[model samples]
Target: MKTYPVKGSVKLADGKPLASGVVVFAAPEMGMEFSSPLGDDGSFVLRSSYGDGAPEGTYKVRIERDPSKADSQARGGRKSAAPAPYPAKYGDESSSGLTAAVKPADNALDPFVLVK
Candidate 1:
């Protein structure tokens, strides 16, 4: 399927960058999904298993911490697991209420600002 570039950033309601996590874009009706790791600045560029970008469609977006990173951090040296930076709701598209529309051209989405 043809795809288009999708990029965006995530920030807290207070204007602080999330710093780490993964951003997902899922189009359930199309059975297509894309994801990207959050940069230190909380920016992302979506890519699917097939390749970079996603096909044109509307998608429900979600943000979650990378499980591998979380696991490693837990076993590494930290005495206690640090609290999650974002609310749990942001991890579930059904409840997160985040969405994006990808067009045939380049798509630079608005920042997803989450509230605590």
Candidate 2:
């Protein structure tokens, strides 16, 4: 299937970058999903098994904690049980109410601002 470049950033309601996490794009209707890890600046570029982009479709978006970062924090004796960077609701696509549309061209999504 053809795919298009999709990129976006995540930030808190306070305007601070999320720093670390994973951004998920789910299109159940198409049985397609794409994800990318957030950069230190909270930027992300979606990629799927097919390539470095997502197929054209509307997707429900979700944000999740990056397991690698969590593991590192645990090894450092930090509280790995700390709350997610964003609200728990944002972690579930069903409840996140976040969506993105990928067109035939490049997609540069608006920043997803999360609230507590």
Candidate 3:
């Protein structure tokens, strides 16, 4: 298999699940990307290649949903306040003790947080 699924929920700043929306994953360095659809439960899953995960760098993630699609696709999700902010950070590596450029296919990017 060349893919795996990542499960998570899209929640509001208030910590409530967002019924429907779209999440996009972009890794410029590795040129790999993915996206997932938010279900009524505000949960989603993005596909990652065999060993492809978020690299050790910054990412620009956006969440937007077509309201019109709601009537056609909304099983039980909400129309969200607004697509969150432009560019949310994911799988950073600055916090890690090791300081090196990402080398995917062999090295894994550990947990790192963005310094907003």
Q: On lDDT, who's better, 1 or 3?
A: 1
* Model 1: per-residue Cα lDDT over 9-99, one tens digit each: 9998889887788999988887767999998898999887766788888899999887667767675576446777778999989899999
The whole-model lDDT of each prediction reads 0.86, 0.90, 0.47
Residue-level lDDT tens digits of model 2 in 1-116: 89999999999989999999999999888776899999999999988788878988889999999888887877567757878867899999999989999999999999999987
Most TM-score-accurate candidate: 2
Worst 10-residue lDDT window, candidate 3: 91-100
The global Cα lDDT (0 to 1) of model 2 is 0.90
Judged by TM-score relative to the true structure, which candidate is superior, 2 or 3? 2
The candidate that wins on lDDT is 2
**In angstroms, what RMSD does candidate 3 have relative to the true structure?**
8.1
**lDDT tens digits by residue: candidate 3, 1-116:** 34333445556545566666665555556665556677876666654555433444444454556355555554557543443322243222222122323333333323121223
Ranking by TM-score: 2, 1, 3
Which residue pairs clash within candidate 3?
19-77
Q: Residue 96 in candidate 1 has what lDDT?
A: 96
Worst 10 residues of 2 by lDDT: 71-80
For candidate 3, report its TM-score. 0.47
